[model samples]
Target: MAIFNTRDRTIECRIVYYGPGRGGKTTNLEYIHRAFRKQTIGEMVSINTTGDRTLFFDFLPMGLGKIRGCEVKVQLYTVPGQIRYGSTRKLVLKGVDGVVFVADSLEVRRKENMLSLKDLQQNLAEQNKNIFKIPLVYQYNKRDLAEEGVPIMPVEVMERDLNSKLKIPSLPASAVNGKGVGATLKECLKLTLHHLQEELKWAVQDGL
Candidate 1:
C-alpha cells in the first residue's frame, strides 16, 4: 500500500504497473513522468540490470483531490517484467495500494499476458491482496497496433481472459503516444480512493 505518513500529514499511495517483459510497463511510467513533470515530486528512477529494469516515479496527484484533509500522492512503479525476475515482481508489489496491468497487444503476446496476469495474482496473494478485490486498472497497451493483426485481443477477449470475475476498470491504451494513459490513471485514482476508505474501516477495527 502507499505510505501515508499521518504523522507528517502526507498521504502517499503506491501504484504498481505490471505486465510481462517489453509490455510497455516502463513506457507508461515514463509517459506520466514527462507529462506531469511540473507536478511530479521527484525523478523517475530506473534500476536497470542485464535481466530487467524496475522503475518508479512520484506525482502529487491533485486529481485525487483531498481525502480526510490530506492530499494524495501517487508513487508509480513497475517491476522487472521478465519472467525470471519473479522474485523482483513480488518484491515491488509489496505495499501496493493499486495496480495497473499493462497488457501487450501483439498477437504473439497473448499467452504472455495471461501468464503475467497469473503471476500478478500469485504475487499479490503472497501479500494478502486479491485481484478480485483490489483497486485495479487494466491498460491494453499498444492499442495503436490493433489493426496490424497483432494480438490486439478484442476488449472482450481480454476481459474474458483476464477480468472475467473481477470487474475493474479497463481501457485501450497506447503508452507510446499517451492515449488513454491519463484516463486509465483517473479511473484507478477513483478506485484507490474507495479502497482507502475500506482500509480505514478495517483499520478502525484493527484490520478485522
Candidate 2:
C-alpha cells in the first residue's frame, strides 16, 4: 500500500491519475510542473516507457495552508496507462485519497475510456476501495481534437454512461493547452481535504 507519514505536524495525501494509454495524463503533469514549478514544493519524478510512460510519478504540490496544526501536502501521481500494467496500477493505487480519471475524447477511443474506467474500478475494489465512497473526478481531455473539438460522446452521454451514479466533479479539458488542469486538481484537492478533515475529527474524538 502507498504509505504517507503524518509526523511532525505534517500531513501527506496521495492522489492518483488513471486513464487509458495516450490519454494525456503525462501532459497534464508536465503542464502543471511548467506552470507552477515555483509554487510546488518537491521534485516531480517521471519514468517513461514505449507504449505508456510514467510507471508512477510524484507531482508534489506546495503546502496548501494547514489544517488542525498539521502541514497539509498534496502529492499527485500517474500510473502506467497500459492495460498490461494492471498489477502496477493497483500497486500505486493503494491508500489513495482521491482519483482523477483522464478520459480521451476522440471518437475512436471512446470504448477504451469505458474499459479503462472499469479496470480502475476493479483494481480499487481489490484494495477494498469503493469509488462511490471516495473522492473522484473525470477530466475529458484532448478537447481540441476536432474542428469544433466537440466530444465524441456528448457530456451528458459520458455522464450517464460513466459518471451518472457517482455525481462527481467532471470537466472538459485540453491538457495540451493547459486548460482545465488546475480546475480538476483544485476540485480533487477540496474533496480530499474535506474527507481528511472528517477523518482527523474522528481521530481527535477518539482521543488518538
Candidate 3:
C-alpha cells in the first residue's frame, strides 16, 4: 500500500526484500544503504539473533526526489529469512508495495528457495492479495560464490524454478560485492512506480 501525504505532496511506498535464510536479502539492503548514502534518510537498522542472522527485519529509508510534483519516499525492509520467523515475516509485509525475492544461488539452497517463495505466496493470500498481481522482481544472488569453488545453481536453473510462472525479470546478483544489486533494485523500483501510476490514474477516474 502506497501512502500519499497530501499536505507534504509526498508519496511513501514500502518495498520488502524477502527470501530464505541467509539468501542475501539483507545484503542487498546493506549494499543499497552504502551505495546510495546520499539518498539515505537514516542509518540502516538491523537486529540479529540466532547465528547472527536477522531476527526481525532490516530497515532503510530512501528519498527518491519528486515525481510529478510528489516527493517519492521509499521504505525498504528485509524480513527475517529464518523459517521460525514466519510471523515476523508476515508482519513486515503488512503494507508492502513491491518485493524483491532474493533467492540464493547455492545449489544446496534450491529447496529452501522454493519453500520461501511458497511461503510468500501463502502469506500474501492471507492478506487477500494475489501474488500474481503484485509488483515483484527476482534476484538470483550469491553468484560470486561459484568462483570460490562453491556449487552454485545456474542462472537458467534458478529462472526455471523461480520465474517460470511469475515471468518477472530475474537478475543474477552478487550482493556482497555489489554486482547486479543496483540493477535488480532499479527494475523493482521501475515496476513499482508504474503500478503506482496506474493506481493514481484509477483513483482519478473513480473520482470523476
Q: Compare the candidates by TM-score and give the number of the best one.
A: 3
Residue-wise C-alpha lDDT for candidate 2, range 40-140, written one tens digit per residue: 78777788766546665545566565555656677788888888788888888888988989998887888899999999889888889897888889998
Q: Return the top candidate by lDDT.
A: 3
Worst lDDT run of 10 residues, candidate 1, spans 55-64
User: What TM-score, computed on C-alpha atoms, does each candidate reach?
Assistant: 0.85, 0.86, 0.94
Higher-ranked by TM-score: 1 or 2: 2
User: Model-by-model lDDT, in order?
Assistant: 0.76, 0.78, 0.90
> Global CA lDDT of candidate 1, please?
0.76
Please give, for residues 109-128, the per-residue lDDT of candidate 1 as tens digits: 88999999999999888898
- The per-candidate count of clashes, in order, stands at 7, 0, 0
Arranged by TM-score with the best first, the candidates are 3, 2, 1
User: Better model by lDDT, 1 or 3?
Assistant: 3
Candidate 3 per-residue lDDT, tens place, 1-208, comes to 8997777778889999999999998889999999999889999999998687999999999998876667888999999999989999999999898999999999999999999999999999998888898899999999999999999999999988888899998998999999999999889988887788777542222211
Clashing residue pairs found in predicted model 3: none
RMSD of every prediction:
4.3, 3.5, 3.0
Residue 177 shift from truth in candidate 2, angstroms: 0.9
Off by over 4 Å in 1: 50-68, 147-151, 201-208
